[model samples]
Target: MNENKFIQLLKKGDEKAFETLYNEYASKIYGLLRSYLKEDEIEDALQDVYVRIYRGIKGFKQRSKLSTWIYKITVNTAKNYLKKQKKNYLSLDFNLEKNKFTSKENVEKDVFDEIDYEFILNSIEKLPPLDKTIIKLRDIEGLSYYEISKIIDKPVGTVKSRLHYSRKKLQKIIEEDQNEGNG
Candidate 1:
């Protein structure tokens, strides 16, 4: 179905429409949430995001694309959840050491490959919440600046600047990690 028709069905409280919307967007939303939230909190955050999406669909003004509106709802819902729980957004529990890659057979791979993945993730986790969110939206999710601005309720210029700063921060983190490993 077309987006307009789907949204109209949603506004009318159609159950199938809700299911369809959920099916369409669930994975992306889950991935986005997973980037910021702990494993235990992701499911709750996902539920809250969908609930807010359903409840707010009727009031959606269509000023932006439906997906953008949903993204905004997801970000806001997750942020609100964090605020209510008094959780530190900067603290991510990756537990990379405990969760080693399991392989049935011993496979020889380059050491560089393994280190880079965890190093990059740890670097990103160390970023402030706003920078992390901007990086996820722009770099991971591949959202345009305008879309990210809408989702985060920032101006496009601000989004661009933050994205630039976040990228630089990530680069510095990666460089520091590499230097430490080399030394």
Candidate 2:
């Protein structure tokens, strides 16, 4: 079924529609949450996101795409969970040793790759929650600035500025890593 029809069914409280929506979007939502939450926290956050989606579907005015609306709910729900727990949501424990390349040659080859995943993830973890969310939505999720503005309930200009600052901060972090490697 088309998205509009599905959404209409959802708004009407169709059980099958809910199931379909969950099946389609649950993994995407979970993946998005993984960037902002720890493994243990994601399931709880996912439940909360669905609850919000179900309850708020009636009020969804179609100002944005359904996917964007769902993403906004997921992001907000995860943020709320983190806030309640009073912990840094972006701090993920990455075991560098386990991820190490087996050979020195391989390590060197991978290190010089265009983007360093570890460095990028580490830098993202250090960002403030809002900046981190903005960067993730814009760069990682490939959301347009306008879509992001709607999700975060910020003006488009504010969204752009935050994304710009986040990118600059990430660039600085990458440059610092390079400098340290050279030194």
C-alpha lDDT of all candidate models, in order: 0.74, 0.75
Tens-place lDDT per residue, model 1, 1-183, is: 788898999999999999998888887787667656667888898988888887888899999989889888887777776788797654443323333322111221232236555566677777887887787666555678899999999999999888777767766776787888899
Cα RMSD of all models vs. native, in order, equals 7.5, 6.8
Instruction: Return the lDDT, model 2, position 30.
Output: 84
Clashes of each: 0, 0
TM-score per candidate: 0.76, 0.75
Worst 10 residues of 2 by lDDT: 96-105
Tens-digit per-residue lDDT, 1-183, candidate 2? 888898899999999999999988887788678767889998889999999999999999997899899998987887887789897746443323223212112322343355556666765676776776776666556688899998889999999778777666766776787788889
What are the runs in model 2 whose C-alpha is more than 4 Å off?
Answer: 92-113
Predicted structure 1, TM vs. truth: 0.76
Quote the lDDT for 8 in model 1.
Answer: 95
Clash pairs (backbone) in predicted model 1: none
Return model 1's CA RMSD, one decimal. 7.5
